[model samples]
Target: MADRDKDSSAESRRILDRIAREADSSGSSLVSRTVKRARDHVSAADVDEKDWVDHLGTRIGRVLGLVICVGLLAWLVMFLVRGA
Candidate 1:
């Protein structure tokens, strides 16, 4: 590949590596256990890695939709208030 493409690939790999390490180090791993009220032991189940990514994507989409809706509402409200 070209030099710039190689550099971009390297950077992307580094970012992916960092994400993987963070996922490993995060306390939210599947094996973690916690006690609930009345001495109930709750264990985290093994969540599929792709499921996590899908969930993140869903959240991002929802946030983007919300922002767009809010912006449109604001513009409409301003226009009406100013009689534009």
Candidate 2:
């Protein structure tokens, strides 16, 4: 029906206009733009590389700290045994 078609067309245009206004507004639009830029400009390889480097760095630091703590405990035990 012609009347039904006109009604649906008008509704769709209203929905599109509302979405356009939201995307233009300041606060939520900034987040939307940032996400769009990250999708467009940032590379998957760079993210992967940074993630790998961070993961390895955290693992290495934890291992080093544990080793140092164990060494200190061993030295303390030896000192106490020798003194006794």
Candidate 3:
């Protein structure tokens, strides 16, 4: 049991170290990485190629989300400017 625990701990450390090294090598800022991930998600890059309906739905959803975000931001700005 003790040996197993030590082995698991060592494995976890190695995985973390590898991940840190890869991240350093990638040299991408957190914001860029986040944007890339978001773009990929909105584009449904991971969705099945055969699922056209799902792909269309994802795109529509992303567009709606963007519209909603923009609308909310506009409303907030107006509210702040008008002192409401």
Candidate 4:
């Protein structure tokens, strides 16, 4: 074989060996993947239906209270201004 053919054959074998090793693995040997999984788990919400309902109820209650407070303040201002 020629010198160029020999060099190309060696490079082909090196690349094939690398591909075989990567194909045989579980593909999760990277620390970045593990860290990403941990970060996703930490930031994930574990809320149930009841928790969602409770949160919604709390928000609605606050909005209702704000409306009531503003209404009462308006009424008080009117009462003082009208002197009645």
Candidate 5:
């Protein structure tokens, strides 16, 4: 049992060290990746062959969806606060 525990601990340490080294080499932080994703989503870069009108509509739709979600969240918070 003691030998097994030692082997497992050493293996776990090695795996964690490799992960840390890879993360350091990649050099892309969480905030930067999040920002890049948001930019791509808002700009609709994933949509292919879209004209200006289509792009504008997509942006508008995204904004409207966001607004609706915020409104709903606010209403929920207010309802909870009021105990209604």
Candidate 6:
């Protein structure tokens, strides 16, 4: 049991070491650090507010048009079925 525990611990340590080295080599750690710094330094006012309004308006118009078209098609179909 003791030998098994020792081997498991050593294997865990080696796996962790490999992961750490791979992260460092791939520059993921640097990217994460840079993202943290950017988030910390970012101000709400730095973002564009107009883009939000424009995006919302565009989405609303698309949804409204879809609803209108669907309602009109349903009405037309119902009217034709009743006539037949």
Q: Give the residue spans of candidate 3 off by over 4 A.
A: 1-5, 8-12, 15-19, 22-26
TM-score on alpha carbons, each prediction: 0.39, 0.40, 0.72, 0.40, 0.56, 0.40
Residue-by-residue lDDT tens digits, candidate 5, 1-84: 999999999999999999897688468887888899987887777666548888788878887887899999999999999996
- What ranking of all candidate models by TM-score puts the best one first? 3, 5, 6, 2, 4, 1
State model 2's lDDT. 0.72
lDDT of 2 by residue, 18-56 (tens): 988877766566877788765443333223456787656
Q: Specify the poorest-scoring 10-residue window by lDDT in model 5.
A: 41-50
Clashing pairs in 6: none
RMSD of 3: 2.6
User: How many clashing residue pairs, candidate 4?
Assistant: 0
TM value for model 4:
0.40
lDDT of 6 at 31: 76
Q: What is the lDDT of residue 56 in candidate 2?
A: 64
Q: What TM-score does model 2 achieve against the real structure?
A: 0.40
- Summarize candidate 4's per-residue lDDT along 1-84 as a digit string, tens digits: 699999999999999999887666577666767788655444332324467776566556666776798999999999999995
Candidate numbers, best lDDT first, in rank order = 3, 5, 6, 2, 4, 1
lDDT of each: 0.65, 0.72, 0.89, 0.72, 0.85, 0.73
What TM-score, to 2 decimals, does candidate 1 have? 0.39
Segments of candidate 1 deviating more than 4 angstroms = 1-50
lDDT of 3 at 74: 100
Give model 5's TM-score versus the native structure: 0.56
